[model samples]
Target chain A: MEIMELTALELGREIKKKEVSVREAAQAFLTRIAQTDKVLNSFVTVEEEQVLQRADEVQSALDGGASLGPLAGVPAAVKDNICTEGIKTTCSSRILYNFIPPYSAQAVLQMQKQGAVILGKTNMDEFAMGSTTETSAFGPTKNPWNTEHVPGGSSGGSCVAVAACEAPYALGSDTGGSIRQPSSFCGVTGLKPTYGTVSRYGLIAYGSSLDQIGPIAKDISDCAAILEMIASYDPKDSTSVKRADCDFTAALTDDVKGMRIGIPTDYFGEGLEEEVKQAVLQVAEVLRQKGAVVEEFPLSLVDYAIPAYYVIASAEASSNLARFDGVKYGYRASAYDGLHGMYKKSRSEGFGEEVKRRIMLGSFVLSSGYYDAYYLKALRTKALIRRAFDAAFEKYDVILAPASPGTAPKLGQSLGDPLKMYLGDIYTISANLAGLPGVSVPCRVDQNGLPIGVQMLGNCFMEKKIIRAAYAFEQARGRWQAPPQAQRKFEKETVSASADDMQRKEKEMRSASAKDVWKTEVKTVSASAGKAVD
Target chain B: MANKISDETIEYVGILAKLELSDTEKEQAKSDIERMLDYIDKLNELDTSDVEPLSHVFPVNNVFREDVVTNGDERARLLENAPAAKDGAFQVPKTVE
Candidate 1:
């Protein structure tokens, strides 16, 4: 089998058995990324020289009889928001276009300690503010299932990297539904661990309390292996949970005999597409047949999840993102009369429209007079939602639902309609709001050939339960086969399409004046080019 | 429910956010914010009066550590990313002078 097609664990086992060298495995995937990622637009930065150098180090370690971590020799892609020493960590925003971190995030350090070779950083929404990667300052990531559809966001690129076999496993951070929603759209397995389970020290903060760094991989076992390596107690992150070492792989037994699964009927009402609802219900029946009890229950707080999530996320984002004002680091305005002018102009020029909109909404909600009506009210509602989850957990071990309301929306369809786009997050946001562990696993494909995912949400720190249930379901259903469109054997037309895109961007940059409302667009396109060339 | 956000409010919020919006953009923001606020107003239907506010989902409080240095300063490497820097400090437009 092709090295790129193996699961991370399989690749690691081969590397250890001397069937394949670490460097050879790295070369195969790096070659695959170069040939495929242009059409996918899944990566933001790919430093070939640095990647090979890291692979050599891993090889030397293995040759010297030194025992490496479980994922030794596995090549993984990191989302751009996570800092990597000397790597350009842009958060897919112009504000951090030239910003390179001096230190790596704890997650990256942990992965490296385990001898995992670094693939390039993947694309994301600007500061992780949008549900679709369309808000990316670089460009939108196309769904591998069908190039016309979006691979959900703000972790779209990371999900696509796994789906397209650009990388065996990749890391993505979730705030609302970023990881799970995109994983659903791209037909991959992504886990958003309980908020404090993984250290967030160098993850570019967007809704600090909600953001979590987790893995996106080809299957549930790969997800568990990656999680085991990264989940640790760290003093660097005050919010880091002080949990005992998790034996994630040990929890992967196919015996979910007496496990109770709750189906929130509200998740199936109104907005959910019929196909998605049916797919999740079928998974529940499969669980029932496997000796697990599945029942339908009403989660009344489902309707309030979206509003509360937005209010709280935006408010935290406004405060967390206030640091980028052209002073210590990041983008600066070329022309400004005074300090205040520089701050305003720099921010206005740096952030994209969606980011700016969220910041403004956040500022308004937290403004002196409206705090009681909006921000505080949302917090109270958040408490009630948590209470509801706590109450429901009293009767169930895990809750199952559609990871997304439907399959991947066509590219550009969710754009221009902010409300409609926000609704796409309704199914997954509650997991983040309640600080639960959630995983999205591909269950079946819709009639459109797009994959539908079943979400399994466990109570805080109960990732083992969800992983067990997902594994049992996965073992029964077999691995999801990638469609022809997903396999990225680069054809000549893809290169031409990429070139056409570049030219179109150059035209937009030229026609746009310094004062245009789309000034950020021009700046970002140009800055993104510099990123690619550098 | 009616839209509660106004043009004046959007303008004020934009100022607070340090974002400069054009007339057309302002019109768009007004409508978007109004619709968003109107939708979020659905929370009023839920009676949360008895529920305590949850600032964080996890039950964590005052994570403290010893007052010893755990990391060394990388001032030079950090300044490498700054748009403008003087001899040893970040340089910004003069506030007084």
Candidate 2:
């Protein structure tokens, strides 16, 4: 069997049976990564030697008659945004490009304790500002499915790694749609656990209020299994939630018989392309067919999500990112003689355009005169959105939506108008604003055969139900296809279709939408290169 | 959009942020701030009277644990990467200097 194709559960069983040494398992993945990483570029750094060493240590433990842990020998990748002790966690920004942290995140520590081998840090957008990995300062991560296309971001590298079968699973941070969008694009299961479900001690804050570190995996079970390990309260993270007293893994039984699924009319009404809407509704139909009662729900306040999220997240980010000045930590400007010069040089040289743009916007929103009007008012509107969700979830077990309006757009296509790019996250951002647990499960492929993900949203701390729904959907829909490049030349040719055709076809898909007024297509001509014109 | 932000307001913000902007940057900041402010102006259309303001999306409050220390004696590692330190504290140039 191809070692790369083994799920975490399979790998665990193999190691437990002693059919394969942990070192050998880690080595197999490292070798596979070395062979194909040139094409995938899924990893920003591959901690090869240390991984083998840790695997050997696990093997030594097992050989010495110690009880093997549940996730023994499972190798996983982490988004660089999540800090790992003594690793260069750049978040794909020049500011922290060489930052070696002294401590690992609590989630990473939990995974390590489960006997999961740490592979390496994966790439992301600088400060996780962009939906496409094209904003990465290091370079864009190519979709393993098609190298020319983008793997969704800011967790693009993590999703791409899982999609390409580089690792059994990867940890990704979602602020807005980072994890789910990338998962949707790459054809994997990704979850953004309820805001406080997982500890956020060492996650580099992109949007402090919204950022959540969760699992991106080949299937929902693996995603839930990983979350089960990582989700717990920690004294270190003020946002951590106490234990929910329910076993997430056990909660995933095929029991949607009495489940009330809410299909938000606003989610499918406008902006969603025909194929994505059809794919989402098809899943809704399947749920209905399976005896689950599905209803069309309403959230009048949900349309204000992007604007509310931008105001709140950007304001928080401005405050959080202020710590990156030259004096404290991160990249320092040694060329400057004075303190002011040092700070300016460091920031000007370090931040990307998007990062700078957010800071400026954030500063403006939180600034005097604007604070009460913009930031405070947006917060109030955010409550309205949350209240609506709170009311709907009272009648529904799960809310449904398309994770992204459509599959991954060509890189340069969405970048021309920033507002248009912001709308790509419209369907997913509200979940973050509501601090709800959400999962994006690949429902079906589009007309162009690129993947589309349908979102399953749940009330706060009900991650188990979200995962259960996603898992059941996966059991029905099937395991995601390994990115075509994972195979040989013939498969590569099949995946490597023309970008022009993909974009034009995506536009045509939008044109065919049942609702004519949404104007989903923004014919961005600049996506001619690797990704965003940015 | 007005496409105008007072130069005085820009200077005030720069001061608050401890930034010294170039004259050209001041012009750019003015326009960007105006556009962003204009965009944000749309929030007034929202009727939030019935809404209870949420400080956190998750219904978590006072997540504070016991104020007891749990083996947090890592001053050495904390100082290990400091750009400058002296006598178990971060060093800075004299404020009066």
Candidate 3:
């Protein structure tokens, strides 16, 4: 009866079995988004017309006896931070609020090619700063389970969209646990693939090295299907890996038979909520029963990740975000004739508070005197953190930890305290620092009925192993209960085929002079080491 | 100097970030930054002399692909986002003159 609550795999089966029409399934998501998005505030822009047209095309293909893809006809959403052509792909920042990218992000384009019916673009923290989605220029995406409670962000909307079943799957970019923290809080599944596994062509840079595009879905299987569609050797992205001979979905197996799963004592220690710890241990027990050799390993210095991540992420962010300076793209403030006026008015009017804070902090760290003391130190510590993970992984196939310390906290509580919200990334940051594959799978619901997640971290390019292990846990954890509020999301979905609104967005953005930033028209700045690989 | 970070430094950083800050922010950032710097200074005490500084965690090895000029999609939308443009190129205020 509730087709919206079904996983991508389940929906695919239903469509193939002729039990549900692809068009009907697309409509169910549209309807769900329309009804529930008001409360959840997950999606910033939904292309309803595009969803129906894409569904029709898929249906036509199915009728003509064409083989459907893994996630055929499944409705999915994109994070606003990711580039989507002709759409208002804001990084939830005012600078890019009215900006429509010339190209779609590599991940979005790939997912579309796989016949995944894109539902819409979801909200995020402005420029992917701040842990709570509250920093979004479009406003915070409320948790589907509780409107008053904060959805952990900057990918909070993506996580909430999946958790609330506005779409069965969504794409999110994680820099310092943007994807995983929200995934944990929203009680859904998300994976921050190995650093170079997914291309970053279209996703705007938050913290360049720290940023990775990942999948947020209801289950590990859904996450896997989306990953298969998105992951590949993208020549456009220099960091992309040549696709090794691997099938992530096919690698899903219940046998960890003799596989070593490590529970780092530091991960389970102080500040970890009892409910989340219990949930992680329960999942570990399931793995143990499946013949996994589980052990308590020592990574005692894990407490240092927050400060290191902040410094590194902010330091990089300072330079990366300097691109939207009212000259090239997006909104520029009026009443400014001079260059300095343009910079001041544009940035001050464009950026939200958290983004401003991060940019300022970043600029400070990277400034002349502070670079060695702050930025360089953070980079050095990042190496140490990577070594800790590498040492642990030499003994263990995968590392297990509670994704966030607890369920989604009450909204407005985490907003005031930036450092406290940052602590949620304590368990997730090291993986990004190490360039390892990490997956967050929901294990159980706490007494409060909010979901608790156990994250599995694997060695580089070992997404297959992590996906397999996460799938095994999903099977053990039993079926997830889609939130009730996300179910009524039976509303219309709207896609931009370049009508009046696109013209208006263009008109609003028409001011000052611009330049093509892609072709190296701007000034070439030096990297820290001076002319190494930029 | 006790290897100490100061209020003036935070204020200077805030200026670089283009943040118009108040008195409270200046003090708060000074304290917060000092706390972080102090924590990171613990690494200075570590004997990492023999260990080579690892810049990238993954073995990237300059993994570059052949550069091919792929046609960028959406001819009209490319200009849609420009604050100002003409003849398919973005127009900007004169500089480097």
Which candidate tops lDDT?
Answer: 1
Model 3's CAPRI class? acceptable
Pick by TM-score: which candidate is best? Answer: 1
Docking verdict class for candidate 2: acceptable
Off by over 4 Å in 1: A492-496, A503-534
Q: Taking candidate 3, what TM-score does its chain B reach relative to the real chain B?
A: 0.59
Judge candidate 2 at residue A139 and give its lDDT. Answer: 65
DockQ top scorer? 1
Q: Rate the local accuracy (lDDT) of all candidates.
A: 0.87, 0.77, 0.77
* lDDT (Cα, 0-100) at A156 in candidate 2: 94
Superior candidate under TM-score, 2 versus 3: 2
Report how far off residue A264 is in candidate 3 (Å). Answer: 0.5
**What TM-score does each model's chain B reach against the true chain B?**
0.89, 0.78, 0.59
lDDT of 2 by residue, A44-67 (tens): 777788888888887887778776
Using all chains and alpha carbons, the TM-scores for the candidates as numbered come to 0.94, 0.88, 0.88
